[model samples]
Target: MILVEGIGPLATIQDLGRPGWFDSGVGVAGAADCGSLRLANRLVGNPEGAAAIEVLLGGLVLRALRHHTMAVTGAPAPATVDGMPVGAASLLELEAGQTLRLGLAETGLRSYVAVRGGIDVAPVLGSRSRDTMSGIGPEPLRPGDRLPIGPVPPAIPIVDVAPVATSTDEILTVRALLGPRDDWFTDATALFDGEWAVSTDIDRIGARLDRRSGPPLERRIRDELRTEGMALGSIQVPPSGQPVVFLADHPITGGYPVIGVVVDADVDAVAQARPGRIVRFRPAG
Candidate 1:
């Protein structure tokens, strides 16, 4: 068992996510950065989709009730065990009664911690992921919460440390395919030409973007469109013209027109982006 000592801004248990629930009005709410979560799980010898703790902007502290193998990944949060510093993306051995604390993330917006055995939380919709938008799954972790660990898996971890990009100030470029409503825009190329800054209004649902200069995307068709299905990474443009890139907990459908869709691989980078980070779009080949 692991005891939650401190919960910083937000912390939640997550797995790969509950898929196939969109038709039922449920969004697949997993780790915002699924690749980082998978990497943490791999370091702990757990399945890639095993349940783990997703820490937002770090500051999560956990105490082990028993011996456990653990790993921290993503965001490069400073970690320590009983006051001794530990490295991220590497295996950590925690003895009984030992405490692990994670400081504020040096870069990126979220960090992940995985134990040898996944967090044994009750599953809702066949997943342990917490959907902040729908109030589904377990509640956000709080201080003094005791989390049970699952039985250890047979697979053994081979790598001591895994290589991962920490974070960078370089403007992030994401590829998108102009889409179903591209014709509605006065100039679809505007999305690719203009530079955008990530807005402060980011969450598990989506990250809003504001153009650095020039007018936002203008609509040629002022007519109200019927609500349509929305997918992860769907770049929806509202009447205000600013684009919002849907994330893990995005709504199943939206009324706003989708100008384009970011590719899946690049969505991970989008999730890690912090407020004020510059982002540029490029046409997907």
Candidate 2:
């Protein structure tokens, strides 16, 4: 067992996510940057889809009740065990009664911490992921919460550290595929031509962006789009014309038109983009 000593604004347990429930209005709620979560789990000898803790902007402290091996991945953050500094993406052994502290991230926005065994939380709808939008699964972690660790695997971790990107580039280039509603806009090319700035309006649901140049996309068909299933990375354009890129906790369906969908390879970069960061989209081929 591990005790949560402190927590940041948003921290929760997440796995690969609950899929195939969108028809029932359940969104796939999981880690914002799943690649990082997978890497952390790998470093701790856990299954790739094991549930782990997702720390937003860092600032988490955990006290171990028993000995355990752990790994921290995703956004680069200062980590320490009993006041001694430790490296991120590397495996570390924690003795009983030791406290682990994760500091604020210098570059990305979300971080993942995985133990030798995955977090043994009760699953909801085939997932341990907390869906902030739907209020499903466990609630956001808080101080004094005790987390149970699953049974550790017998196999040893193969690697000491995992190589992963830590910084968001000066201009985040997200590759996108033109969509089912591309014809709704007067000029879909404008999405690639103009630079967009990540707005403060970002959450698990979506990241709202403001186009730095060019006019708001004018709909060729002014009629509203019927509600349809929305996918992760769906770039929905609302009446205001700003593009909102759906993320892990996006609604199952949306009424707005989706002009493009960010490719799976580039979705992790979108999760790292901070407010005011410049974003540019390119056609995916």
Best by TM-score: 1
Model 2 quality (TM-score): 0.97
Q: How far in Å is the alpha carbon of 95 misplaced in model 2?
A: 0.5
Residue 225 error for model 2, in Å? Answer: 1.2
Residues 29-110 of candidate 1: C-alpha lDDT, one tens digit per residue:
8999999999999999999999999999999999999999999997889999999999889999999999999999877899
Candidate 2 residue-wise lDDT, 1-285, digit = tens: 999999987789999899989778888889899899989998999898999999999999999999989999988889999999999899989999999999998887898999988999999999999999999999899999999999988768999877765443688889999998999999987889879999999988889999897666778989978999898999999999889999999998989999999999888889878898899899998
Q: If candidate 2 were superposed on the true structure by all CA atoms, what would the RMSD be? A: 1.1
Candidate 1: segments with Cα more than 4 A from true spot: none
The C-alpha local distance difference test score for the whole of candidate 2 amounts to: 0.90
Give the poorly placed runs of model 2, Cα more than 4 Å off: none
